[model samples]
Each structure stands twice: as structure tokens, then as C-alpha cells.
Target: MMRIAIVGAGIVGLAAAHALLDKGHQVTLVDPGNNQQRPTDGNAGWIAHMDVMPLASPKAWRNLPRWMMDPLGPLTIRPAYLPALTPWLLRFVLASSPARIKSSIAALRAINAEALPSWKALLTTLSLNGHLREKGILSVWRDRNHFLRAEDIITRQKNFGIPLEVLQPEDLKQIEPALHSVEAAVLYPEGCHVSDPALLAADLLRLALERGAVLVSAKALAVEPANDAVHIRTDGAVKDVTADRVLISSGVWSRALAKQLGDNIPLDTERGYNATYAKGAFGLNRPVMFEGEGFVASNLDTGDRVGGAVEFAGTQAPPNHERTSAMITRLKRFLPHLDENQPAKRWMGFRPSIPDSLPVIGQADKDKRIVYAFGHGHYGLTQAAITSRLITEMMEGKPGSLDLTPFSAQRF
Candidate 1:
């Protein structure tokens, strides 16, 4: 048995801890404990196994200027940060090539192919199955032109073996009567979502604790090699910890720590915001993604959550609450019957993003005692279980079921 220290206590870190414990390892998880800063608490919560397309695409590049001009659009890069962000931006643009997109889709599909089964197994083992809902998700388009443009994407998804069902206006109304002004929709029957993301995370943490894993509420400072073990420094009373292995899964903050281990990874934060309404504010059976608007509205346990946006603002910038308000405005336009007077809660969090829209999940150093597992971007929730399983396999020196080269930290 080995002693492992995992930096980060969000879903990814907690999931990794659970996997290590299942393998008979002693785990200590460290986090800053700032609930507001954690994306797991406020994400859209969709388990989108069928959505394997990378965000950086030729279409997105063509619309970049328009999106940049419209500050309230789905994607924006803060002008002040553009100078320092040039390198990452160039990489992002380069990743938009057709070949790169095809490669990314194949790699992402490999990971997503195992996502549902892995999540189901983990939930069953942890006895937290009640937190998930398998009603599937709907992607709706309001404009006929926009709907027509999605044919290529639908074709590609079909080629990749993703099950899809096209829905006309009447069909869409029958599936979600509350939705208004939808021109068309597509349903991915295999999709699922968490009813309450925060509660689900709490349940995972509880299960980890029950399995003899330790949770340390502190900020991780740095990690270094110490003799045959890995040394970790944190802000808690037990400031230093020595472990047989170390896993860096600290989300957006992972880049700096990986750099400390001699790997300079190009990672940035995709700032996302959300708005939640009262539970009874709207009636919806499943999560719906507004195609052109680039946001998602899902019925959660607490209420209906309207979330989606890709802002290039750095992690430290103050959130622009107007983004959440704009999403609510768009949601109201989509569902005219929604009560505008209902109190809404707003939140913003950072998603660790890479130029290729793929995660970095591999060894950080030559010794292989330290591992890197971050840069999951918007699909973090969907890919967390598969990532954990792969990490466990790597730590045990076993060949993982899927190829890890595509997601290797050395790829950068």
C-alpha cells in the first residue's frame, strides 16, 4: 500500500481519492475550502457522454470577431488580459485545424465512452445513486439557419457512434412544453445529469471519508521530490506531508504547481457563470442547451439552473454579474411562462482549460511518483470518473484501458 496526497478537494480530487482508497492506498486530500471558488458546486451538472466535440473550431474562429464585439455574447476575452494571453490564444487558434479537431474528438470519445459506466459503478459503490437523473438532455435551436448549420455536427456525432434523435417543433413541445420559440431540437437519449451538484460532491466526500481517506482543509503551497517520496506543503496545521505518491488535481491552479515539477503546461481559466431560480419557478424534465445562445437550462433539485458562457478573464478578476443576468434574460425569453419575479442566485467559477480542450492526465516527473490531472474545462464533471480510474491504473503501473498519449501533460 502507498500513501498518496491529492491536492484539490473538488469532484476530480475526491474521485481520485476514492479510486486510490479502493486500491488499498492511504490518501490525504487538501483544498483551500473556499466553496465559492469551486466549479463543482455551480456547474450545469450534465453528464454529457455524447457531447465529444472540442470547443475550439473553425466555426468559432469565424465568429470570433462578432463574439468579441458583443460583450454579452457566449464567448468573450477580457481586453486587459489579451497581451499575456497571446500565446495560449495562438495555440487555441491552431488547435482549430480540422485534423486537430478530429483527433480531439476521437480522444475525447474514448474517455467519454467509459464515463457513464464508470460513474454508475462509482455511485453504486458509494451508494449515492439517488443523486443522478437519467432523463437525457435536449439541444434546442431557435433559428432555422442555426438549426441547419448543425447538420455537420450531427453527422460527425453519428459517425462517432453517438445516438441522436432529431425533434421537430411539435416534438420538442411535447417533450418540454414549457420551452418557447424553439425551432428544432436534438435528443441524446444516453445523457444524464446530477440533480444537485453540490450535494453530489458532498456525498462523494462523505464516501471518501468513510473509506479512511483524510480531508485537509488548507491551500496547497507547493510539491517537490523528497528522497523516494513526494513532499507536499500546505497551509493547514500539518503544514507538510510526505507521501509515496502525489496527485495534482487542483483544477485551474494546477499549472503553477506542475511548473514547479519542471513541466510548463499552457493552461488558462474559462470563467463560467450561472443563475439559479426557486425550485417551483419552472417545470422542466431535462437539461436543455440553447444552441445559438450558448447556455444551458436544467431543472435541478434546488430550481432551474441557467448556465453557460466562456469568458477569458483571469481567475482573479471580479465577476461581471451582468453575465448571469443576461443568461436569465435569455432563459426567460426561451420559457415565457417562467416567473421573472422569482428570486435568482448568481455564481461564477473558473474551469481549467487547455488549448486543445483536452485534460492533462499523466505523470509530471521522470520518477512517475507525481501525477497531473487537471485542465478538463467544461467537461470536468462528465470526465471525472474515467479520469480517476485512469489515474488509479497509472499509479498501479498497469496499462490503462484507453490511450493516455492524447491527454499527456507532455503534449504541450
Candidate 2:
């Protein structure tokens, strides 16, 4: 059995550790404890399999000015970080080209199609199937103009065989009475939701531990691949470790570590903000996406967690909680009865994003001993299981079922 070391304890890393252990590998997880700012802790928790479109689409590029003009709009970039962000933005523009978006959609769909089934299998293996709620999610648009503008993409998604239902005004009211009058609502019946993503992540880590995988609390500083083993340097009680192989799944932080290993991946951070309120705060049945708002509100068993937005800020920048406040303020228009008085927990997390929206998931330096599997962006929660399966397949020297060309570490 191979001795594998995984960096980052987020959903991707933890799921990978569990998969590696089940394959009889000795696994060690290196993470810097669980911080609220970690993406795994504060994502929208929707297994959005139909989210195959890349964020850098032609439409998104056209709406850039309007989105930027509105400081609290769906997408924003800090003025101070604009210089550092220009390169990524330029690449994003390139990726928005028709050809690139088509390829990106193909790549995303390959893994996304397996998302729900993969999660089901993983949860079943862990005897935690109940953790996954297959309740459908809604994408609602209040303005007829917005819905009309979105028709092209909606039609494209339907053409791709994604099960989608266009609900009428009266139909939406009967389905989700909590939502105020909406012009149109599209239902994705295949989407799944997890009541508490953090709790589920803890359970996955616990299972890995029970299976003899070791958890090292530390921040990985560097990754050095030698002839025999890969060396991992970190800051914690355990300073360093050497393993037969290493998988870098540390989200946005993976960029530096990958660069250290001769891969200049253009991985940047999409600083996302979120707020969790007491149960029954807005009383929704399932996750609801505000069609044009670039955010979603989900009714979790624990409470109502509303969040989403892409802020092009570097990882080190302090979060602006004002973004979360803005979402709540806008959401109040839809759910006028939304109780802001309820106790709420606010959070901001960095989502590791690539220009094309496809994750980097393959061997690094043409070496099977070193692999890279970060950059799932906002869909990390949805694709984590499938990614783990592919990672395990690669580590086992078996040909992966899906083509790795699109997700290759060398793609960039």
C-alpha cells in the first residue's frame, strides 16, 4: 500500500483521505485546524450538478461594468488588488470565448454528471446516506427581462440533458410559499443539499481517522518532490513529513505549493461571504437561487444559510462583511418577512478559482507520485466525491474512467 499525504482538510482533502484509506493506503492529512473562513465551512452546500457553465461567460463579461458599478453587486474586485488581479481577469476574458466555454462546459459536465451518484455511494459507504438531502433547488428571477435574457443559457442547459422544470408563477407559489411573487422559477430536481456541510466534513474526517488515517494539525508551507518520496514542510507540532506520494488539495493556498513544484497555475481566490440565521428565519423548503443575484439561500436543518458572490480579492485580504449584509438587504425584497432580529453567524471564505472554472486535477511534473486536485471553485462541495474517486484511481495506477486532459495540472 502507498503511504499518501494529503494537504488541506477541506471537503476535497478529507474525502480524498477516506478514499485512499479504503484502498488500503496509509493516509496522513495535513491541515491548519478548522477555521470558519475555510471554504468547506461556509459554502452554499448545494450539490449543483447542473452548474456546468463557467463563470467567465460572454454574458458575465458583458454584465461586468454594471456588476462592478454596483459595489455590492454579485461580482466585485477591491481597488487595491486590481493590479494583482489583472492577469487572472485577462485569462478569464480569454476563457469566456465561445470555444473555451464550450470545452469548459464539457469538462464540467463530465464530473458533474457523476456528482450526485458519487456522493450517494460515498455516503452509503460511510452509512451516512441520511446526510444527503435530494430536495430540488429553485432558481428564481423576479424580472421578466432577466428571465428572457437567461433563456439562451437555460435552453443550453436543457439541451445538455439536465432535468429542469420551468414553473409558472402560481406553481412556484404552491411549491415554495415563502418566496414573494417571482416572475419565473426553474427547478433542478437533481440538485442535492446538505444540512450542515461542516458537520458532514467532520464526519468524513472522523471516518478516515477510524480507518487508521492520521490527521496532522499544521499549515503546509512547502512541498518538495524528491526521487524516492515527497517532502512536506509545515508549521505546527509536526514540522515536516515525507510520504510516497502527495496530493495538494489546499484550495486557494494550493497555488503557492504548486508553484513550488514547478507548476505556475493561475489559481486565485473568489472571496465568498455567507450568513447563517436561526431556523425558520425565512422558512424555505429547499435551496433557492436568486437568478440574477449570484447567490442562494438554503433552509438547512440547523438554520437558514444565505450566501454567494464572487469577490476578486487575494487570499490575505481581510474580508468585508458588508457583502453579506448587502445580500441580506437585497433578499429582504423577496422575503419581506425575513427576520433580521434572529441571531445570525456571519462568515467569509476564499474559494479557489481558475479562470476557466474547471479544477486542476491530475499528476504534477509528469510524476504520478505528486498529484494536484484543487480549484473546484464554487462547485467544490458538489464535485468533491467524484474528485476523490479520480484521485484514488490515479494513485492506484489505474486508468481513470474519465479523460483527465481537461483537468490536467499541466493544462494551464
* Cα-based lDDT for every prediction: 0.87, 0.88
Residue-level lDDT tens digits of model 2 in 1-412: 9889999899999889878888999999999885767899888888998887788886676567878888888899999999998989899888988899999989988999898888888899999887888889999988888788888888888988999999988988888998995888899988779978888998998888998999899999998878878889998888888899899999998998888788899899999988999888887888999977778998887789999988987877888888888989888888999877677999999899999999999998745688999999989999999999999999888989799899988887
Please provide, for model 1 over 30-144, each residue's C-alpha lDDT reduced to its tens digit, 9 standing for 90 to 100: 8878669678899999888898788887556655776677798888888998987899989987888889998998898899989999999999988889988999899988877
> Could you tell me which 10 consecutive residues in candidate 1 have the lowest summed lDDT?
58-67
lDDT of 1 at 177: 89
Give the per-residue Cα lDDT of candidate 2 at 116: 85
After superposition, the stretches of candidate 2 with alpha carbons farther than 4 Å from their true spots are none
Models 1 onward score TM values of 0.97, 0.97
